[model samples]
Target: MVVYLPSLTLFCDSLWTKKMCGAVVLFVFMCLTATTHADHHQPCHSPNMTGLMNVMSLKGDKIAQGTFAYDSMGKKLRFRSNESYPTNTSLGLDLLMLFEEGIFYEIDSKNQSCEKKKLQMLLHPLDIPDDSRFYTTMTAGSASIEGEGLKINIWTGSIPHMKGHYSMSVTMGCLPVSTFYFTETTTLLFSNMEVELEIKDPHLLVVPPFCHGEPVEDTPEGTVNSFLNEFM
Candidate 1:
């Protein structure tokens, strides 16, 4: 005699439900463990870290209008400026500022033909919190300097995610006589986006008096004059 199992369908359905629940529980546990691991290895919140980001952004007018990313372990910094709208001009300039053991290197872009003399001098990284001081200067056909401005202090507890603020002034000049001030604040994001920079008080800058002329290489002055005359 053959016996029929009438409750087989119900038993199979129960087994499928149990397996699905077990898989969901396993996924949840994995996610929790990953989050805990990340929390354990996360960088400690520091006032100096936030300040560094702010100082980098405050350096110049062009610096304010770009996206900045930094790697803490690698000590690598990258910034890219969005091209200005309506003009469709490329404003992207890449700087690989490697900060290794209190030293740095500023790499120039391909389009720009930079001689070694035009490079900026390396300065000590600014120590945040108690002492916020950093010094560096760049000289090309023109010169500009980045340093810690007055009234920089670490502000804490404004945001849970942010560590602190580093305030500083940025100055640029063609000649030492022509200079402008830009106030900035750096916030430590403490996540994939490590830093956030906000320009607190930005002042409209005026270019200093400087010479501008194309070199008359192999072309005579009169030949250039005739070309100008044709345009006129």
Candidate 2:
């Protein structure tokens, strides 16, 4: 089911000063302390799943918005976007990352050309992670209205390997709703998620025939974000 995250856009106004906005964001985080009796547990690590969702990433003044599908069990992710930002355009417009093979394919749909590159890093699944601290429990929408909302647990922590501070909202049933990730400069938000517990098609994870025989390019240095370290 599609989960709409309203919180991410609450402070997106350009009229506010950056320093003031930062303080407001910090205050919101400080207020979400976990209950004393609650267990600080991470979301379930589901090995098999594939679904599509909207993605928005902000790095400095640049913003990238798109939709992506992923197969956790197959260890693959594909992202597509209409207009691209410099932060993401470094790889390619349409990209596919295959973690198991340590490679990625940049597809040029118009020309049906695919460029391959070596993926230097391992895949980081969307799990909340063991180091994450439980923040609090809250509802996304009105529980009184049927089929409108679900209970979610909030979490925050730094991923030492990735060097980013992150906060995520996960359903009580272990599904992810939204995620916010930040480093010294960049900020990423993954919202409007719809995750399935099973793979929809095996071919979704397969490298297309057009990508075969393409010379692999060396991967450049990159930083970790919500998904891949450099290629998210």
**For each candidate, what TM-score against the reference?**
0.26, 0.66
User: Please, what is the whole-model Cα lDDT of each candidate in the order they appear?
Assistant: 0.24, 0.58
Alpha carbon deviation, residue 59, candidate 1 (Å): 14
10 residues in a row with least lDDT, candidate 2: 83-92
lDDT of 1 by residue, 1-232 (tens): 2111111112222444433533442342243211111121111212212111211111111122233444444443443344221112323343434444222222234433321111122211221222333322222221123431211112111111122332221212110111111113331111012223322212101111121131223433333211001111
Compose the digit string of candidate 2's lDDT tens values, residues 62-121. 233444566766667777655332344333357677877777887887887887877554
Model 2: residues >4 Å from true position, as ranges?
1-37, 40-43, 47-52, 57-62, 83-92, 123-125, 130-133, 141-149, 160-162, 194-198, 220-232
* Candidate 2 local Cα displacement, residue 209, angstroms: 0.9
